[model samples]
Target chain A: MITTELFVKMTIDRWNGSIANVNKHLNALTDEQLQKEIAPGKNRGTYLLGHLIAVHDDMLKLLDMREKLYPELSEPFIQYADKVVEPTPTASDLRKMWEKQNGWLQEKFAKMKPEEWFEKHTAVSEEDFMKEPYRNKLNIIITRTSHLQYHSGQIVLLN
Target chain B: MITTELFVKMTIDRWNGSIANVNKHLNALTDEQLQKEIAPGKNRGTYLLGHLIAVHDDMLKLLDMREKLYPELSEPFIQYADKVVEPTPTASDLRKMWEKQNGWLQEKFAKMKPEEWFEKHTAVSEEDFMKEPYRNKLNIIITRTSHLQYHSGQIVLLN
Candidate 1:
């Protein structure tokens, strides 16, 4: 049988590995490339990167880790689509936010023990959690790993 | 603690969810759109779809489930990048193969018991798996789920 600790560790490994891949892809792109859309009339690399940061930032609230490192990111990246919110932070600033936010999250996530992951995230009500314990904090991490990879592929297409 | 059965079920749920999203995107795309590159000089939608099938087809061997559903896909989609091979299966044929193979694999995966998921897959040796038990059959599914989501994002960009 797989121990819960090992299972949680492997899941974390997948999350960290995907974050690394996105960083590699992002670093390889020029600022001008980040500005280009993946295709005609589609999202630019910068928009996708900003979107990833905003989603990951919300995980703080979703998992009850802390207040968002950059709540300002939510409006540009989440509530609006690529160009809908004219004048987002520069690609350079988004890169810094991505690094700082992910670094902070990595430290916080490492401190989370296996059993703690099985408990409900803050987004769920106590009553709802009692009925559906499967919607745990770790499930959010797993789903977000998939989300990060999805956007990583989109953003990397700019290269 | 969560039961082994529940954990495995949750993981499978994620795999199916991603598959459903991919299918949704594929169905919405016309064949003409599939021929276009995700970005200029990047992979076409048809190539990404075929690549996804080839990877998933290889999982039959990787998971020790069965023979690959389409050995032909390995050369064009896996061995070479898009357009390197003289011609690939029509987008229509690829869509059918994708449906047939994923349908078959889903059936096979649903039959696997939670304990079986922790066992080494065909690709791993007994000694290696003993030393690295985390490299289990279920781990392949998890990683492949991420891969599928990655390409799904790329393919969807054709829309």
Candidate 2:
């Protein structure tokens, strides 16, 4: 069987791969391109980018890794569900924030031991976690990795 | 650290989740809606569905788990890169084919032990696998899960 260490390493690799893909989609598009909707009246690239930033920021809180870097993004990008209003950052600004968020996650994740990833996240109660240990910190990364790729797919649609 | 068993189980759960998401997108759209381009000139939902079917069919071969059920799909969906020509399967037929494929996989995968997932896939040479044991069957599932999510994201654009 594969070691727990290898499992952790592979999960991180997939996370990084999704991040690279998301960046590629974001970088290839101009800010103007990003302003277009992914579909008719659906979430646009701008909202998707901001949404990802908010979700990743929440990831930090969920795992108890650190304080959120952009907690303000949660309201408009999430919670409200794409009835996006003004006073949000431009696509250009969101791109930079995406980079900043990923950079912070990479640093924090790099320092964490593989064993630490198996521990339950803040969302799960201690008693519940004892019963369902698979709901751990690394599982958050697994879900987020898929989640990022999902948005990345839509981001490419903005192209 | 989490056991290898738990890691395998979580990976499978994510795989199942992505499959369910893809099915949701497929079932929601009319066959006509799926024919529209994901973007102005990029892959359409139809091609994405076919491409995913082809890729998953190949996954069975890659893992040496079973023979491909739809070898014919490789040409239009895989080798040609979605410059689709005439005589492709209807969306109804493709949907049924997808159901058949997933049913077979569910049965096969259900029987597989966690340790079997750690064994090297067919693509890796034995020598290489010895040096890099992480190139295993489970890794393929992990990748294909993200891949399905990526397409599912784009498929939602058809709505």
Candidate 3:
């Protein structure tokens, strides 16, 4: 039988594993390398980094874990396409934000009980969530875990 | 409540969505673009595509849905690092393999009853599977869905 505790553990393991896979690539790059395009006519490493940070920041509210920590990030990183605007965050700054935000998320995840993960997050209403029971807090984690890995695959190309 | 049917549907939706996301970027690229490096010292678009095909091919056995269709893909795409080998399959051949393998997998997926996904696949024994129930066949689908999106994100950089 699939117990709630086992499901939570597996999900968290996958989440951390995906993040670690991305970090493996990110840690290998230098400041100069982060500015280069992932491919010709594609987003730069720095832009992707900032974009990831912004998305994770938004996840805080979306998952009902916390309020937005970096609301300013949405405009440049999430709103505009890569290289569409000037004055983006430096790689170092974005790295700092990534670490801080992920650290907080990790702590928050640890505090959550397995049963609580089935409850609706802030993004959904209690009624809608009841109707569509699959769209639970755990689903958010699964989707975002994939999202992180997706960007990580792109970031790895910078090496 | 989070029913098994709901979980299966959500997983399938994310699987298809990730494929769609990759296709959007892939459809925009020219044949020549597939040869370009995702970054200065990274895999080319062709390599990632072939790699994805090889992985999905492996998934047939991993999920116990079918037998291997392209065993040869493992040599160049999975075993060797990028650009380490010559005489790789052409872009056309790999693309065909990709489509065919995915089409077969989709059919297999469609035939599965929701509960079947919770059973142990060929890769795991009944004894161990019982001990770690979370390592069900469904978990493979979940992980590989993320795997597809991860590389799809990289392949998109070819645009």
Candidate 4:
């Protein structure tokens, strides 16, 4: 009984729900709170936010939707360790990046049709995609949703 | 593309991948490390493992696959907060429970056909399920995979 439309809707609902849950904790953070580590040695809340934004920005290309909005975020936030001796973005700067990237992602998702979700994205070849049909554009979104919520759970430790 | 078979395979792959990532970190943890909080004021690695065990136990019934292997885990691990007055399970006890539960779960998942995943399980009424086909049996697994990894991400902070 699971139609394509219903599948897409369910994915979107969970995606948004996970984001809302993370944002609730994120919005409550003070500048000082953001700088504190989620735990003693783990990455700081601010670093996680920037890392998430960088990853989501990469999703634009991975999902073959569009180019990244913030390619500049990759080095400090994604490539380097949080404890590395380098300058990092302020909590406010990362917050703006997160908001902007997700805002655009939301708009992009809204425009996608159910059928389009089944088509191959940038990652795999047309022939290869046919063999592993589930690795469609929609699957990327589903995987990323989990990735986002995984970090979100860590971020909630700041509460 | 994006047939039900591919969807089921993708879900199973991600579920297994998440478990492997968590287990890689888990296998390396000393007993003392399990007792340590992932971060100060956050749940200990022990609690997260037990909570994951309890939730996967619930998944048995939720997916209509089998009865729970450890019904007792529900109270101390799932229903109650970690700081409650109940006696907690040791790191070894929870580790055994996790292994046993997942071993059975992997076997159970291997037996499921693609069509079975699309059918509604025991939770929803037939009438309501018909209306909202998105609430299929497979959706539970999809959501839980994310739930497992979310906590797994938190637990990895101990490393």
- Each prediction's DockQ against the real complex: 0.72, 0.70, 0.62, 0.67
Question: Would you list the clashing residue pairs of candidate 4?
Answer: A39-B39
Which residue pairs show backbone clashes in model 3?
A38-B38
DockQ of structure 2: 0.70
lDDT of each residue in B56-83, candidate 1, tens digit only: 8898898888888889989999999999
**What TM-score does each of the candidates earn?**
0.97, 0.97, 0.91, 0.95
The Cα RMSD in angstroms, rounded to one decimal, for candidate 4 relative to the true structure is 1.6
Give me the candidate number with maximum DockQ: 1
How high is the lDDT of residue A143 in model 1? Answer: 94
User: lDDT, candidate 4, residue A15?
Assistant: 86
Preferred candidate (TM-score higher): 1 or 4:
1
Relative to the real complex, the DockQ score for model 4 comes to 0.67
Candidates ranked by TM-score:
1, 2, 4, 3
Tens-place lDDT digits, model 3, residues A1-159: 756676677678888888888888888999899999877788899998888888888878878877788888899899999887788888898888888988998899999998888888787888898788878888888888879888888887777
Native-contact recovery for every candidate? 0.64, 0.72, 0.72, 0.70
- How accurate locally is residue A103 in candidate 1, as Cα lDDT from 0 to 100? 86
lDDT of 3: 0.82
Candidate 2: residue B17 Cα off by (Å): 0.7
Off by over 4 Å in 3: A84-86
Alpha-carbon deviation at A53 in model 1, angstroms = 0.8
As a whole number from 0 to 100, the lDDT of residue B15 in candidate 4 is 87
